[model samples]
Target: MEEGICYLTLNRPQRLNAMDPSLLEGLLEGLQGAAAEGARVVAIEGVGRAFSAGADLVEFYRA
Candidate 1:
């Protein structure tokens, strides 16, 4: 958090920042934290070639 701006980064570059349960949970937690901290802006970013692969197909298939 910097100057009321919250930065949420997806760190699963190995998996192209896939949207899995854990990632989703972390994002939700970050949002809540940002709100609690009175953040005026929330920025979501991914650390990889793709912002997101949409979803984890392998995990989805296993479920």
Candidate 2:
């Protein structure tokens, strides 16, 4: 990884690290950081079996 590279790992393993608003914000922050740092790469990883389930429907269902 580049020194300027940014990464955000979704720590939700049982739930497949589904994307939430917080995760979105984190991603945005990472993107901004990478851009600000003039990074050539930004990577996102999940601790679970999937990179992401796209979004968490259960969380959305509450809203």
Predicted model with the maximum TM-score: 1
lDDT of 2 by residue, 1-63 (tens): 468677767787887888777777877887787788887777778896888888888887886
lDDT of each: 0.93, 0.78
TM-score, prediction 1: 0.89
TM per prediction: 0.89, 0.76
* Model 2, global lDDT: 0.78
What is the total number of backbone clashes in candidate 2?
0
* RMSD values, in order shown: 1.0, 1.9
Give the least accurate 10-residue stretch of model 2, judged by summed lDDT. 1-10
Q: Write model 1 residue lDDT over 1-63, tens digit each, in one string.
A: 999999999999999999888898899999999999999999999998988988988877886
Steric clash pairs (candidate 2): none
